[model samples]
Target: MTDTDIGYRATRRTVLPASLRLRYRLTPWWVKVIVVYLLARLASTVMLVALASVQGANPWTGAHPGYFDYASIWDGRWYDIVAEAGYPKSLPIGADGTVQQNAWAFLPAYPFLARAVMTVTFLPWSPAAVLVSFGFGLGAALVFYRLMALRLPGSTSLFATVIFCAGPTSPLFQLAYAESMYLFFLMLALYLLLKRRYWWMLAPVLVMAFTRPSGLAFALAMGFHVVYRWVVRRRDEFPVRERVASIVVMLVAGVSGIAWPAIAGLVTGVPDAYTATELSWRADYIGHVHLVPFAPWIQAADWWFGLFLQTSPWLGYITLVTVLALFGIWMFAPSVRRLGVDLRFWSVAYALYLLAVFFPQSSTFRLLAPMSPLAGAIAQPKSRTYRVVIVVLCLALQWGWLLVCWGVDGLDWSPP
Candidate 1:
């Protein structure tokens, strides 16, 4: 059977009876995405509950955490605080002439959604946040599946979806985090851009800007597109008006990418309000630094060295080797050629952006969740045994990551 046929049969076997399955054989591809989501949810929930069962005081609330409690720990706590109390009017500063960690550090999109959901349904912030994540996570998966189908067959796309869900940081999608919502907007923006719906892409781009600092990746990709059309392709094919319109759209996207931080700075009366709050988390580094270009590499080096030098120096080398390997893949992998120029450019730029701005920590991999679409570009295994082994390894690592990094009582030391 073809890969598409295999996917259809697997979906049919899940819900429809043998007699009725034949009648519904032409089910929409999205139903299969939903099936994949349900399966991933089940696996993640089981693993999360297993860890929560061994919990002490939940760091976020200082209460004995159940499953919901575990989901809202770490950065989720800050999101909850923002949702419940809202950001302060003035920028918070510390005694040493530095910014302090505050709600301004987090983007407001996810918390606003959670608060709106809570108002509509009369649920607490914890469950409401998870519900928002679950719904948006499903939508993101559906859009992601469609995007993958543009380049992959049904079975391979399904495998990519599975890999996205079973990624080590992917469980955050089922929690009270903004990863899912941000991804929903990010992928939608990319998909719209890929379809060449230039003006229509602005809506998601605007929403994405308020979701995370990484929204700039979209603008960067569009800027590359402009350079390709005007310079590389020499602008000979399209009409002048069409070319001008596309350029306008890209310029709008570029500004909207940094609109959130700019607006926040203006409102808070601090020209660098967002940067200050973000840097506050690393105040212990014993140095003054601006959020200028290439700062995160130095910050990541310092953080990782401090973390591993006393514990296990080998871990630092392993981390370096892993990053270099992924960089090599982004640069030269033949499979990446199939992802088209837009996604390929976006993925590499996004990776470099993360390395430059984000400090490496426990939540560092979680920040990379936006690159889940790259799973579609991964070379597939030729043998069933290899495929099975890869899936098993992915799921095992996810569970292991949660238990080791997320479940401990004092994990508040690092962002989740």
Candidate 2:
């Protein structure tokens, strides 16, 4: 080839990437967020549709169910029951006298909204549920960008949203679940808190309380935030009125956090109805046991180690402690600290809350989606190679999650 031909080819190659980057930079911020969202949903749709094509007769649907049918499989049925029949006047009791898996375990917010959509659009539970989830997922993406922009540069904030959209549990975004709804409100609440819009924060806080089991975790974050403001009062100037208002909001949130259990107990004659129903799901792995504060993880570890692996349970205990310690240290990393006090405190509080109450299992990854704010720290590094690698890894894990957790493998124990 002539030297001129070689130079022209090199110039064309250089100009192509630069032109694409320029166009991308020129796009509006909201459009960029929506673009990544569409891309993520497209990729997830392909995987779920492929799974549906091969899905055999399961509890919820038959072989070769469509996309909406597949998305509504696992917890969707429970939501449907809630929407159609409402929570039971009497809890379903098993022969063992423990609460059986019932509609009481699910929060009413997502299903209530789905039923509303059904009323308006005349669609069935499956499609209506998917629509509600998708709408909330879209809202979550938009609010998450605004929240991230509060502390990070615009590009970093957008990348964090991308990471969040493509995360393993992101399938929940399109599925018939409450995770998407809860996440939207959670990000909005956090954004309002950071802006010091205390009164405006109450709206999201109340909605989030009824959406999922996140009220207690959010209260803890707010409580720590109050203390943080007081500690840095000299520099940050936490006024007396602001402190009092903050405390009031925190107390109100804490009460709201525990209100569902009380409501469940009152409606049903069975006191502890909510707690019992929740524990029933875990009973599959560890048999029937009373709920104890800060004991679930240890109990779960012993079950996995001693029963499943036939090994010393002490090693499991040691490993759990070590992992928790490492997680605590990770909170102090420079990148994580850059997320600001509200995000950082929320991370620590939520992690401890999960460590105390959650049993480590397949659902654990889905639960971790609440901590997606930490994705900002991961997005902080400006390495193009690293960003591409992480995006690929996220999608790969998405496939793994669908196959291992969401798919109804024979005697499937993992539920997304």
Candidate 3:
């Protein structure tokens, strides 16, 4: 029998019925992507539980509750406050209603959603945070998987999803922080844009505007994609009318992302209200040295490069080698270079923008997290021994970083 006939016989002889076998045989590619994404997310949840146990805390309680008992949970407290009440304004001024601080300074999307969920379901914000965390993490994985499958085959795409879920940065997904949500929106926007679903892409881009100031990156990347298509395809995929509408949509998303903080600054009569707070914190904790002429660019580069040393010293050393390897790969691998208007350029650009804007916070590395998919797409072994060594070293370094951060307790929930 031919391969097709032999495969059919094997399926019939298997325990699964013919209908079930056919169903599995014909499972849609996207459904398989979702399954892999969910499995990776479930694995991440298990890792979180294990991390919490090692830290002598209950992962189920999460960061907010853990904060009450441990000072390490300070970052979780900010998210809690943002979730429960809107951002806090400064206390009451004189009877004349003078404002002291702008509570509205905090971005509204995450906290607003958190509060809405609590109001509707009577679920505490802590558990709600966890639920949102899980949802966003899974959503991000699914989007990333789809994005990878656009450029990679099934096995490579699945491996990329796993790496994203279990990489050293995975702990961020378990925290009350906004990385999970930010990445989810980002990946969704990218996926929709790749699929040429411009209108659907606009919705997530709009929501992303409220998630973080960095949401603008999504719109900008989409704009780049449009320009790329115009140049290369010459196909009126986005007609003149649609293109005009998309421009308007991008403007709205970009403005809304920075609206709250901008408004807070105006209300408080301090142009640098939020920026000052972040700068002060960075200087005090991270020893950030401001540079002249190109302060933002310098800070951004410092931040990206700093990730190797700041997060985990051991990982830092491993990352040094990994960086070298990456540089070599990028130089030599024509396939990776030709992957085209996908994540590689977008991620590097976003990372640059984040670094320039945020002054090199260690968390900035997470902005490049999407590159993990690209990494998996290009991962191949020229020789058996070489593949085994690289895989073991990379996984070991990633796990070691995860363990150290988890053992220290509450790294994600609180600021460094």
Q: Give a tens-digit lDDT track for model 3, residues 125-180.
A: 76666667667877787778777777776656665566676666665566565667
**Model 2 bad stretches (over 4 Å):** 1-20
Candidate 2 lDDT by residue in tens digits, 94-212 = 89777888888898888999999999999999999998888889889999999999999999999899999999889899999899999999999889899988878888888889989
The clash numbers for all candidates, in the given order, read 0, 0, 5
Pick the TM-score winner: 2
Q: List TM-scores for all candidates, in order.
A: 0.87, 0.96, 0.71
Q: Candidate 1 lDDT, tens digit per residue, 1-416?
A: 89999999898887578657665456777887888788888999999988877777654554446778788877888999999998888987668777778898888999998999999999998899999999999999888887887777777877788787677777877898898998998888778767777777778877877887776666677777777667655544555765776677677777876787787788888988887787777665534567766666655654567554554545555677688697766656667777777787788778777766766666777877877878886625456787778778888988877877787656355556
Compare the candidates by lDDT and give the number of the best one: 2
Off by over 4 Å in 1: 1-25, 62-64, 231-236, 239-242, 285-288, 310-326
In angstroms, give how far residue 382 of model 1 lies from its true place: 4.5
Model 3 Cα shift for residue 11 (angstroms): 13
- Report the Cα lDDT for residue 17, model 2: 100
